[model samples]
Structures are given as C-alpha cells and as structure tokens.
Target: MSETIHTGGCQCGAVRFKAHGDEFASSICHCRMCQKQTGGYFGAFATFADNKVEWSRGEVSYFVSSNIAKRGFCKDCGTPLTYEWHGDGVSLAIGAFDDPDKVAPNKQLATKSRIQSFDTLHKLKVREDTYGVEQSCVKLQNFQHPDHDTTTWPKE
Candidate 1:
C-alpha cells in the first residue's frame, strides 16, 4: 500500500511541512503548558516520526518550554505548530493540519489539568452570532491562510 502523507503548516503559511507515513498516534493534552502554548483549554496533536517530517516552506521557531520539551511555532504568525518532547516523536497540532478531521484524537493527556468548564462546553447553549445582525452588513474578509498548501502567501 502507498504511504500516507499528511501536510500542515502555520496559520500565515510561513511554515509548511509534509509528514510521511501513517501517524503514530493522536491525542489531546490538557496540561498547563499545552494550554498556555495553544492559548486554549487543550491542545490536540497527531504524532509522527521525526524522520518522516519535512519542512517544505520555512523553518519553525522553537521555545524551550521546559527541560523535557520544546514548543515549535511560526515566528511570523505565532501559530503553535509542534510539541517536541525529548526522546519522543514530534506531535503536530491537530488544528494546523490541512485536513484536521483526518487525525482524530484517540486519547486525552494530563486530565488533572483539564478545565472544569471543558466537560460542560457541549452542554452550553449555542446561538447564531447573526441573530439580530444584518447578514449583508456583515462584510467578513478572511486574512488567515487557506487550509491547503499555496505557492505563495499574502498574494504578492
């Protein structure tokens, strides 16, 4: 069978990568460090072998988050991209993937640090943002990079 190829990058399209082979695993981390890095309640990631990843566009900037690990992100857009734990394979942020639905997280980590509100998030009431607003008056322009790879960014 052919190998599975996973493509992903930072929000600004400054850093792109292609991961070869099947993903080793997928998980959502609720550790405090993860929450801080992602600026969210938790971080979802898909693990892959180091050798299988290739930086196709730009290099990733890293922060030494701790003695055991470092976090990778885009310097231009500050998009959290990877979590590299010492001696462990790289884990790419699930939201950064070109097709995030492809990598469904099968496990949760650091549950002790999970926010209590997270469990009730689904039960919260949902409402459309345009409830009383005029749809035509709301002119939305998306500046964020597209979900697929692009030859050039910012359309210069």
Candidate 2:
C-alpha cells in the first residue's frame, strides 16, 4: 500500500503540493483535452478529496477547459497540475508526484480517444542511464527540483 502522505510539484519548482489520505481513484485519461494540456498522449491523475491536497508552495492558475471542468497548472511555468470536475473531486497529475510509481493507477479512461501509439509504447527501445554519460551529454548540474521537498528551493 502507498503511504498516507505524498508530495510533489512542477518541473521548475514553482509549485509544490502534498497529498494526504487514500485516493478515490487513480487513472490515466486519454481524452483529447487531457492530451492537449499535457502535450502528451494521455494524462495520468489520482483523484482525491478537496481537503486531501495542501499547497505547500506557490499557487496554480486554472484554465476553464470546459463547462464542466477546469485544468489547473503552474501559473509561472505552465506545468499541468490538476483536473477538476463539476461533481467529482480534484485529480493531481501523476507526473507531478515525487514518487509516481508509488501511486500507480488502477484504471484507464477515455480509451477510445487513446492514440494508437500508446498501445505500442512497450515495443519501444529501452535505454540505460549510462547512455547519456557515454554520449557525453550528461549534465554536470541539474537545475530542476529534487524529488523531495526542501526548506528553501534553488539553494545557493
């Protein structure tokens, strides 16, 4: 079972959040709106009660994608963070989690809208981490936020 509390944020460290308690649902959505928002084939999300999430840093700007739903993203960096439905509770982006594997999805939705490429993703070539170093492309420094939270970001 996953931990009771999980934390994560945007790629730029502009936003951070903590999710507490069990999720109502966890799924990968293949809807067009989700795809366009994430600039990917699908959007993975974990549904939780409104009170379950606490914003530990930065605020999110919401885009009204449809009459019944709105998308929440980092206002500064435009990292897609959430999806809220009219009647359903909020859903946090799986990619934004510090440990996405821990909160693995048990379901998938809007499968008809799923692109053909997604079904064949497993056939793609797998590369090891050493590939970057071997190609002399490994970064000497990483400016992105670490997986865990910190007292201050972008430490000097």
Report, for all candidates in order, the number of backbone clashes: 0, 0
Instruction: Report per-prediction Cα RMSD to one decimal.
Output: 1.8, 2.5
Tell me each candidate's TM-score.
Answer: 0.92, 0.89
Candidate 2 per-residue C-alpha lDDT over 1-156 given as tens digits, one digit per residue, 9 for 90 to 100: 866888999987889999998656899999999999999999999888888889999898899999999999998778999999886478999999999987788999999999999999999998755745855655466678889898887786
Q: List the candidate 2 regions with Cα displacement exceeding 4 Å.
A: 1-3, 127-132, 135-139
Q: Write the per-residue lDDT of candidate 1 for residues 1-156, one digit (tens) a residue.
A: 899888999988999999888757999999999999999999999998889888989999999999999999999999999999877589999999999888879999999999999999999988857764576647766678888888998778
Deviation from native of the Cα of residue 116 in model 1, angstroms: 0.8
lDDT of 1 at 138: 73
lDDT of each: 0.91, 0.89
Best by lDDT: 1
Candidate 2 achieves a global lDDT of: 0.89
